[model samples]
Target: MFWEALGSAVLGLALAWAAVRRLPHRLPARAMVLPTGAAGALFGAFLTHSALGSAGLPVILVGALAVSAASLSLLLRPAEGLRRRSATA
Candidate 1:
């Protein structure tokens, strides 16, 4: 379980970093993104594992990654709106 969580965190961080790099405009700082991604992935993995009762590791990991990405995107989305509003102001 520890290794699973760590793996999920690392994967999440990498995915988050890639996403941050792909953004057309700057959003949040790396410090914020990293923790958020890690936590999101960890929580996602835990949730999937618990909910499924006895799922495979691969399934849990994939679910973790997907949820992590979705959560990060959702978290960062508000910043985009704020940026747009500021620019228009």
Candidate 2:
């Protein structure tokens, strides 16, 4: 459990770092994406752990693959710029 928690934390940090790097230049560091990515990763880890409790390695592997594929699909979707703030004087 200790190692799993440690690994999850590290993974979360890594994802957060990646997100921060990909943010647009106009965005402020204080409002950057690291926190969002980190939170998502931690939540995903917790959910995955809960769902796979006492499961065998093969089942765990399949579940991970499914989750990862879904996440990748969502991430790769084209951004509609829905979150962009319009310029206002």
Candidate 3:
């Protein structure tokens, strides 16, 4: 369980770091992104573990990655001029 948690955290942080590096303009500040990723992964691990009951390490990691990516994706900023204008306006 300990190793699973540690691995999940590391994977999440790495995912966040890669996203920041790849899309610095799209993501919010590191302060918010880093924690979101970690928390998301941790929550994902717990959730998966509860649902699947230690199915396997790879499966748990996959679940963690999926949730972490989703959480980070929420922090992404939309491109300029991409907002849909009100049709009635």
Best by lDDT: 3
Model 2: per-residue Cα lDDT over 3-66, one tens digit each: 4445555555565565446644433462434444444555555566788775544444344434
Please give the RMSD to the true structure for each candidate, in Å.
4.0, 6.9, 1.2
Off by over 4 Å in 2: 26-32, 54-89
Between prediction 1 and prediction 3, the one with superior TM-score is 3
lDDT for predicted candidate 1 compared with the true structure: 0.79
Can you list the residue pairs that collide in candidate 1? none
Q: In model 2, which residue pairs have backbone atoms overlapping below 3 Å?
A: none
Question: What is candidate 3's CA lDDT for residue 14?
Answer: 92
Model 3 pairs whose backbones collide: none
Candidate 1 residues 1-89, lDDT tens each?
A: 77678888888898888877876265477778777888889888998889885587787888789888887887554444564545557
TM-score of each: 0.77, 0.48, 0.91
- Runs in model 1 deviating more than 4 A are 24-26, 77-89
lDDT of 3 at 89: 79
Per-residue CA lDDT of model 3 for 16-62, tens digit only, reads 98988998988889888889999899888888889999799989999
